[model samples]
Target: MMRQWGLAFSFLISAFSGLASVPPDAAAQDRPAVSQCQAIARTLPDVVYASFSASDVLPAQARAEAVRITYLGHSTFNIETAGGVSIVTDYNGWYRPAATPTVATMNKAHSTHYTLNPEPGIAHVLHGWGDGGGPARHGLVVGDAYVRNVTTDIRSGGGVMEPDGNSIFIFEIAGLCIGHLGHLHHELDEGHYAEIGRLDVLMVPVDGGLTMGAESMSRVVTRLRSSLILPMHRRGPPITAFLSMFDDSFDRSYATGPSVTVSLRSLPRKPLIHILQGV
Candidate 1:
């Protein structure tokens, strides 16, 4: 059922543009129910800066309503939804929360980005790359969250372009669209953007060299214009360089801790670069 739509979307990508596209099935709302993030197009204003504490513990009322995002270092993040569904993004063997994640998504760009052997308790393990020679397709509702992916190419060992080698996983939960850019190696095109749709929070790779250059990556950020940008796969100077590109137009914020609880009501009025403590 879900796989059919995913496969159809994959075929659409191959048949038309080399880039991924949102399938008719998804556009027709035949799959995992549509979310507010996809339904509403938010136009946000420009710059402001603020420092705040991103508490690990959710407030009483928010505990059953908001989405908790915790940066576990590198590209791995533990995203916990109100419905008790936990998802780990770029799930390598290390850098995870104490409890096992209900859903684990992995990319195979490097060993740090994924692991072949995930823990036994995980209910859903989605690979960014496909089994044989096809795009990794995912569109499903797990608990209260809707998860899907848009495929992208990756740089292989010999510098060849491996089609559909990576996936940008989008999670619709707590009325927010959260996207994790997995080991992304190239700049996205119009079709890719169209497939991705709206994102409230975007988890991106800021390692200027390993993924893509700051200039190119920043272009994608500007186009997406997500309210909150969470930078991952960061090293020393690249993080500074990446933020500098948006300094004039985007607000910058430093979180006291690794965790932040976000709901539709909590999104920043202006676009912000939220730097978590560990990453």
Candidate 2:
């Protein structure tokens, strides 16, 4: 489905190219300090460096001042909250996509949902509980940002007993609490729902084909009652279905901007549903 096999060789070329023409091991001192968070300018203001290497985990970035959200197509997202918490969700984005991340979230339940190679410099890498039920439970705090993992129910093909590690992330940053649902295969039960309380921004998968259908996603957004809803993973019918739903529920407006960067100081004003035109 995605040309990931080529990315490794390409990564080596890109990594070493940035390092000088030598064996990468020789340039160990020039590895970009992947263990720490270094703020780099992207189209968004405060994106940190992280890698989604598929086998390794990143350290963590502390002391972030702003949060910027960039849609890397499909379900992949790079989020930097004003408090300096950087998060990447279901990182199966493009190979050489313009932006890398500081922290990446990978869910192994579906092939299209997760990718190999996070951005070149991100630190922490988190995964949801997968079908095999491995390495899904994780918790980390970066500066004032607190990130925790919560596993929810999965019923593939509209709630079948697939036992996937669908993840719900809680980000406490900038006096705002936002959550991203990574390839969710089913609706959240009571206990699962209870853990994801008071979400200020909700990143959801509108595409019903890979994850849950539109009705289930609608129920999820309603259940969370988030202040802002950012739609992802819905490149096909899910986008149409999600927009139709949003148009009916809230004053849906297409955003002239790429992302809706919000801080707590600007929140508690009524909820606004923004859809990006160029995502």
Candidate 3:
């Protein structure tokens, strides 16, 4: 799987580099002011959507439109866009993959979710909490992907609410919108929904208590309405409990391997829970 992804990623890097460069000023002028979710929701097709569960059999030429998602255990996922942008979510000092990511998104809820000293090779290290301000704000576009964050409160050791202590990082790439709910502590509100818009894929922590109760997280999942769900940050017992919360409205599948390639064309007609095997 890694070998196949590497080939595709390298090809995309070369292909994207050869494209005519857009001046920063001109690119900024073309960017929309609305959130990615709202933008995708407006353009959703009326026909029934479909999903093709692919392991590592994709052709190298399809790399241009494919977004490969590899679970790196816990809440960390390596997202490689067709434009060759690489991102690691909830990046801890450990669970480092062989490939050095261009962007690393971290949260402060626990030591395992962040690192103060990241590798020098990483170009962008985004923290979810503020350095001293209210909440951290990240809006960056690299190659073919745009990354941004939405703040959420977390529970302190004493169980007190730590405002804006966590983040929900959203990545818009390859014409698909993906979201990572990092260390979510409480249920979402209207403001969150408005900011989140429509997600084609969601990476959520289903550890029952670490992030939230299974029932609570399930409700949040229902509200988000993502076409595909990736489970993370859970052991066997927790994963089983979390799975039981979903009803007939959703379907569940276990991946034979750690990575699954996706594209806008492969999103499911109904919501799905994909249990990737890397963990």
TM-score of each: 0.80, 0.67, 0.81
lDDT of 1 by residue, 1-279 (tens): 455535534443342232114453354354434433332121111221121112222233432368999999899999999889999999997887999999999999999988999999999999999987889988867776778898999999899999999999999775567999888899987667767767879998898878898898898888788888999999656468888888666899899999988876678878889999887
Q: Higher lDDT: candidate 2 or 3?
A: 3
- Give model 1's TM-score versus the native structure: 0.80
RMSD of each: 10.0, 14.9, 8.9
Q: List the residue pairs that clash in candidate 3.
A: none
Q: Please, what are the lDDT tens digits per residue for candidate 3 over residues 1-279?
A: 455545544544443333225643344356532343443223332212233222233233433387999998889999998767899999996977688999999998888899998888998999999987789987777776778898999899889998999999999775577999999999988767667666789998888887888999999888786889999989456577888998998989999999999886678889999999964
Q: Name the lDDT value of residue 160 in candidate 2.
A: 55
Off by over 4 Å in 1: 1-32, 35-64, 236-238
| TM-score (C-alpha, index-matched) for candidate 2 | 0.67
Candidate 2 Cα deviation (angstroms), residue 202: 0.3
